[model samples]
Target: MIKLKRNDKIGLVFFLAFIISMSLVWLFEERFDQEQWRSNPGKRYKMAKNIIEQDLLDNKSKEEVIQILGEPVTAEFSDNNILIYQLGTPPSFFDEEPQELIIVLKDSKVIHVSVNQEE
Candidate 1:
């Protein structure tokens, strides 16, 4: 039979607590970042608007969007050759209230873009 000593039990308890705390921190960090981002919806919306207005929609590529917006929060490519660039808080935490930018691409070129701000 295997037996754990008193020190071993103490170490195990501490290790479990440490893991739980880390998991909680990791989960909450995303929520905190989203809260901070949503707090400035105007700024984020303006950024998206500028990307659509100034850039040449017909010639703009994915790389160009990245250059203009730094990076998107999420991206999705469909089988129908449509690419979507989503910016703002992820949907996991902000399920009911979420904001995002939808950039539609056709043949690797920007065809349409829309800023969706959920209230």
Candidate 2:
């Protein structure tokens, strides 16, 4: 076996630690769940990434969206062809605004989906 210098050993340990920690994070990352979404609003941010990446809401009908995500936070936004589901405040050290899952619709079908901070 090759012997590493002290500094090289330290660097190797740190690199291995980073790889392990990142793997743990990926393993624990949340996936979208309808029940969890309706029950735990605060955890929506964890699942939002999955939804967008999978295009889960894309091209779905308005009623289908409601069935999947429950009702929008308010009806006022619906008039403008947008559905907003409050995702609660994201986990952050900085003062971050609450986020929302914005689903845009056209002709009563979903056209786009995104997670955006509430203004």
Candidate 3:
């Protein structure tokens, strides 16, 4: 059997590294594709609108909001009168700022649903 020379060993190492990298990339291709890397302001706004107009806010409990919009990334309760739910990625070049959905409740019913889009 022939032993590998110094250059041959270096080349073999580089080849192995490349193969490993390619294999990892191939294995994770589907996950990479599923990630949302670009901003779709319109789609996010539409989802927020649907959440508001579809009477999703009729249920006043936090669990109801989760059922309607999946789990919110952020939630706030102030004085039991105001509720804020924020969703999506934080402000960035690749994604619009998190969208805030404010629900004003009266008598355990939604009195107003406000959709705010960050600039």
Candidate that would win on lDDT: 2
Off by over 4 Å in 1: 1-42, 55-58, 78-98
Candidate 1 local distance difference test against the native: 0.58
Each prediction's RMSD over C-alphas, in Å, is 14.0, 3.2, 14.1
Candidate 2 regions off by >4 Å? 1-22, 76-80
Between candidates 1 and 3, the one scoring higher on TM-score is 1
Top candidate on TM-score is: 2
Candidate 3 weakest ten by summed lDDT: 30-39
lDDT at position 79, candidate 3 = 47
**Poorly placed runs, candidate 3 (over 4 Å):** 1-44, 59-63, 70-78, 89-96
User: After superposition on all CA atoms, how large is the RMSD of candidate 1?
Assistant: 14.0
Which residue pairs of candidate 2 clash? none
Report the lDDT tens digits of candidate 2 across residue range 1-119: 99999999999999999999999988998888999999998879888999999899989998999999998996445365888899889868996889999999899898989988988
Against the reference, the lDDT scores of all candidates come to 0.58, 0.89, 0.58
Question: Cα lDDT for residue 69, model 3?
Answer: 48
